[model samples]
Target: MSRIHKFVKDLAETRKTPKEIKTMVDTAFEVNSISQSQIYRISALVMAGRTLQTRRARTEKEGPYRRLY
Candidate 1:
């Protein structure tokens, strides 16, 4: 998972306010700002038990392994 994703997931799970989450994300990423909607969307996914995937994982190729009977 991306560090940013993990950070957001942690804070969201802990019930931190969305504003706090956004502030932390901006500081950690060294960005001028991040949109509140993005934070809300990510937090919703985290609360729903969805795992965040990094870019590499998103494009990684799968190996062919046949299942054993």
Candidate 2:
């Protein structure tokens, strides 16, 4: 993983606040600043132990079709 992603994951694992994480990430990656809102989004994904696109698919059956997880 990229250093920024690793750093953010570490901080999220420690239960750091979004503000704190944003500050640390910004300081660590001065050339590529990230917004606090983005930090919140990343931290939430990290804490959830999954990525945004990794959700289970809908399992409902439709007449002749069904969704798989």
Candidate 2 has which clashing residue pairs, if any? Answer: none
Q: Output the TM-score of candidate 2.
A: 0.58
Candidate 1 residue runs with Cα over 4 Å from true position: 32-34, 53-69
lDDT string for model 2 (1-69, tens) is 567766887888889998888878877788556666667877877787875344323222243365432
Q: Which residue pairs clash in candidate 1?
A: none
Overall local distance difference test of candidate 1: 0.72
For each candidate, give its TM-score against the true structure: 0.58, 0.58
Q: Candidate 1's residue-wise lDDT over 1-69, tens digit each?
A: 567767888999998888999888888889755578868877876776765564235435443443221
